[model samples]
Target: MKKYKLLWLCTVLVCLTLVFVGYRAKAQTFNSDLPFLIHTAESLNGKVTEWTLFTRETVHLASNKSWNQKTKSLHKQFPNMAWTYVKNRDSKTYTGISRKNNYVETIKLLSTNVNGKSYSFLIYEVSGKHWNDHKVENLNKMVSSQLDKLYDKKPVIFSCIQGHFSDKIDNVLLYEKNRLLKSLQAKKVEALEENDFYSVSAYSSKLSQELSTKKKEEMNVQIGLRKSGLGANTNFVIGTPIITIEY
Candidate 1:
């Protein structure tokens, strides 16, 4: 009996030590590198979810080397997340999928030349089901906190909309470099010339339809879509608005 008791006690201590070591290792792995901010949003159908994190510094590494390093790190941190690797001529991609909730994370490294200089750009994105909003929010917060270590200044643009067509003219609030430029109300006639940022009177389910040939030829613009109606399932009908923000 005494011998059995001693063996059991020794086994318990070893198990506790291993658990503590693993916890510390996980903590260390997630502590060093993190994203600046995580953008989380749900799809129109709410069937799919998306999270994107942009890093301040661009990654400069050989295509193969970068792919291998990222794959190793992601696999280590998310041991349960199965990973698939693919290599193309100018880009390497690694995608990880969580077994628990079918969450997916993709890391891509693309080789490009800027001003005759070769560069590697890294993009990290994740998507999953929108069933648990709190879980998604918490995950983003934790990931961003880790990425805050590599925080650097970068310009970002954002916009918001207000007012209903029936009550008043719909207004768009635009921000650039974290400063509000102006609030634009829906106009009777869309401007022929493009400004730094502008809103158009166009409404379309397809983003490509909003831009005109002249506008595309003259200026560079990024487009965003905002949909409002009876609900996400409501089809195109009366009072349905699909606002496009071109910046």
Candidate 2:
């Protein structure tokens, strides 16, 4: 009886392990390569209910508490929420709160000078904002707003509506920033590899600042995006769109 019970227990353990592995495989779409941020979001939905990507230290994208408050405000303020999975380490789950509630505001601390002048960046803390902030609302009105006050032409906007982020926009916000720089004519851009200390934007500003110290200088505008763990070695099979704009 004891030997038979042992055999039954072993069989049950093997079956249970197979079930667990099967469940996880079904939960997160197992793609050998991650395509784009858009593709990742679509593949992860209704899979594992919710799973945090491998814990990468959150970089506190927003500098202050107000930014967190804004995220919360947008969460509450928006009527409809859009679901998206972001690629951080593996992938993170994101929900689009309404535009009124989802506006994001962050400050880029400038390292040095730009175009012969000290370059510093700061924006007012939006305590309560919404997803609508991401909307392609009045590009006309914002043409006069600070968002583009300094630019000559709107840097090739890839905007959709404000309430929810389409696969297109998710790839833009979380991915395209770097790829765009390599394409811009007015500036010298460099595509930095992972673990590089500075983003392309930061690098551009710092370069301009260094140039200011030397002699004549130009403002080198650089768009930047960082990569995550969803690369070729992972289970990021397909259906996810990772937006990689040609630079």
Candidate 3:
């Protein structure tokens, strides 16, 4: 009886130890320091010259800073700005506007906390009647620079709604990812199919097809490093390719 009890206890301890180690290894595979979405945003940013910063948000942080405090910090960086706030049943939006060289730049900040992580969205809306590719590139670069300065350590995921249907954009994104993986000296990179989430509805079908067709010529490859062990890497699509980065 004593021997049987000792064997059962030993087996339980070994199982628990294996479970804990597996969890830790899985956690390490994800680039917790920089979310996959941020990497995708950066990749897309490099591909487009006239993309708008539709939204930027963060999740799963250790900070306890209030939304007001965070917004105030951002405001200090951009002096001579006017802000307006609107409250809805679910969320609040604080919008800041500034004009430079006849171009109106608007930054809308939306704040909410879910579970324990603070979520904030910085929406950059640039106004110009004639927004050529050159102008668009400059605007995106300027906004991205400002964002980088504000959230140096935080991982920001961005969405671009303007150039979602362009085949050129898709090609550039794939090229960049391939180039990046090669630069990283990754042993192998594999393309992932669009998830069912993007294939369910008609609207999603259109967007997913445009962004992630299996056709080799038009393929929106979401390359993943095979050695990363991140488990079936998936493409991020929100009417466009959102996050496609490997740790």
Candidate 4:
């Protein structure tokens, strides 16, 4: 009886240890940029107008034959999407686009030459113009999983979520700027660029990706606001590690 009890206790301990280690590993790998971007945009009473997630990674192939083979393998991963091949003087690209009622997804496998050196890159982007928040989370997970399988090393990821208010706030650019900073819990503003019509602020967020150093400042979150030409509406864009989309 004593031996059986000891074995049971040992088994429990081992199982708990395994669970804890697995949880830690998962927590380390999980990216929180998209979720937090959505949450923050929604908190500001702005409806989600559009969001895009992009990733690019460089790959190496021994020969043109291997490059073709790699392209074929990548196409197999997205069998449902139709692919279009475009070859230029200096580059070759295979672009696949899939469309749904609410969103669109585009994937590109490109090989090009620069300064007499050959380079290959894989790019995946998903964008939607509708206001479905639930679908955003699902799309983020799907994209993250796909990228993990495609890249051996960590790829550069850029996420941008855009929203708009139907009626503008007084001094919308500055007003929302302060509100957004507070909501993000960002104490210091790393960078700022503004005009009468629009403004962009950069900050570091604990929930965002690795710090991006710019001019001796460490920043990862980028928020932009532009006054809409029509009505009193104000448009905003939030990105982690910087916003790439034109606002």
Candidate 5:
């Protein structure tokens, strides 16, 4: 009886140890997880520009400290801040944008952490009118490069070892995770004709509505970028892909 009791105690300790370690790992990962949406737009010119938002969780993006700073020099002293679908690759397909295009660097927004404070990221590449070969080669590179500019950490150059991706499965043209992903199309042409502010507000409003729908649940989302499009108008619209979560 004494021996059996001793063994049981050891077993319980082992199980507790495992649970503790697992919890710690998850906590660390969550802190660094930069949740974001990937989308695409065209310059006033016909250039297709790819982009990503760390997150515009009204709480952070609304902060004055976020969108303005050009350099990280003030990040410590000041404290910080911060697309579309063309196709489906397959059962093994994971969508991310390329960073080779110049538009990607300019339009790219900085990180905006929410209440829990998680960063954001976007990957994009531009191909003229066809997406016969939609590659994810720059997904990691572009993200890493921008990480260097954003954070002071040395190993900022990083990749998501454990992240999820999807294609336009339901909205067919806008969302990747079928059944739940919502579509938010911006004002077609009239908004842009007025000026950049109208177009910006229109784009932000649509994105905000789509995000609000997802907030009802507890899932994480990574918006996808479409490599090709039907060319709706002179403006290169930013397309959204909804990623819903159950846990």
Candidate 6:
């Protein structure tokens, strides 16, 4: 009886482990908006050259000592990073950059004092040019983990990707607008800006992040395409909510 009971317990434990793993795998599949961006780029036959994720929060600090403590804490958290500081008349900023073989991560802490009250704005960003689908999962995990630790409440995140196609196509803006709307299941809210070379602003249900304007409409998922002035390549930018980096 004891031998059979031991075997049954082992089997149950194995089954439970498998179930947990399966659940985590499923959760990871639709966790972030990066995969959708990657898919759209692939569909357009573009090679992704750069991508970025950024989030920021503002919090009340007690004093300059608190600011220093926060910076020291970040230094310990990311020991490999070197930090630089800049000060102006009203505020001081600390910028730290960590460069790996493929990706670069930046953290900025801006502090200001107003009428004896101190405030700090914390910003975190990560960018890379070379990554595959599996590596993207790691990037998402890294961003989520750090943001969770840094802020008690969730911060709004912006994701941007840049890529290029070897061959230039005519009417690239209209081509991308239609393709992305189909790929993202999104509708055009309004063209924030459009020209012969670029298109921006749209909305999609597939994305979890969105922004609401006074117009009573939500805007998320922005796309921009511009032709290379000298080459036969076309460059594109895809961002969720909005693109913060310069195109």
RMSD per model, one decimal: 21.5, 21.0, 16.9, 16.1, 21.6, 16.9
Model 4 deviation from the true structure expressed as Cα RMSD, one decimal place: 16.1
Number of the top lDDT candidate: 6
Per-residue lDDT tens digits for candidate 1, residues 110-193, read: 556567666665444444433344464566565455344222322111111221112111332122111111111122223221
Q: Which residue pairs in candidate 3 collide?
A: none
Residue-level lDDT tens digits of model 3 in 1-247: 3443343344334323322232111121111111222344345442222323332444232343566776786588776779888876556777888877736777777766567555666655544322343454555457556556645332222223212212233334445445544432332222332211121101111112122222222221122211111232223232122222111
Candidate with better TM-score, 1 vs 2: 1
Model 4: per-residue Cα lDDT over 1-247, one tens digit each: 3543343344334323322232211133436476677777688787887878776666787688998898799789889888999998999998989998877888888889899988888888878776465665676577778777788855556778888766554666777777778888765544343442443445544554544333345455666666645455777777766566654
Count of residue pairs whose backbone atoms collide, per candidate: 3, 28, 0, 0, 17, 0
Q: Write the per-residue lDDT of candidate 5 for residues 6-113, one digit (tens) a residue.
A: 433443343233222321111211122211222222111123322222311111233334433332332332232221222222211112333333322222333434
Comparing 2 with 6 on TM-score, the higher-scoring candidate is: 6
Q: Flag clash pairs in model 1.
A: 34-146, 34-147, 35-147
Q: lDDT of each prediction vs. the true structure?
A: 0.32, 0.26, 0.38, 0.66, 0.26, 0.71
Residue 27, candidate 6: Cα error in Å is 10
Candidate 2 versus truth, CA RMSD in Å, comes to 21.0
Q: Mind sharing the TM-score for model 3?
A: 0.38
Q: How close is candidate 6 to the true structure, as a TM-score?
A: 0.77
TM-scores for every predicted model: 0.37, 0.23, 0.38, 0.75, 0.24, 0.77
Return whichever of 4 and 6 wins on TM-score. 6
Worst 10 residues of 6 by lDDT: 20-29
TM-score order, best first, reads: 6, 4, 3, 1, 5, 2
TM-score of 5: 0.24
Candidate 1 residues lying further than 4 Å off, grouped into runs, are 1-57, 62-70, 99-103, 112-118, 128-133, 145-247
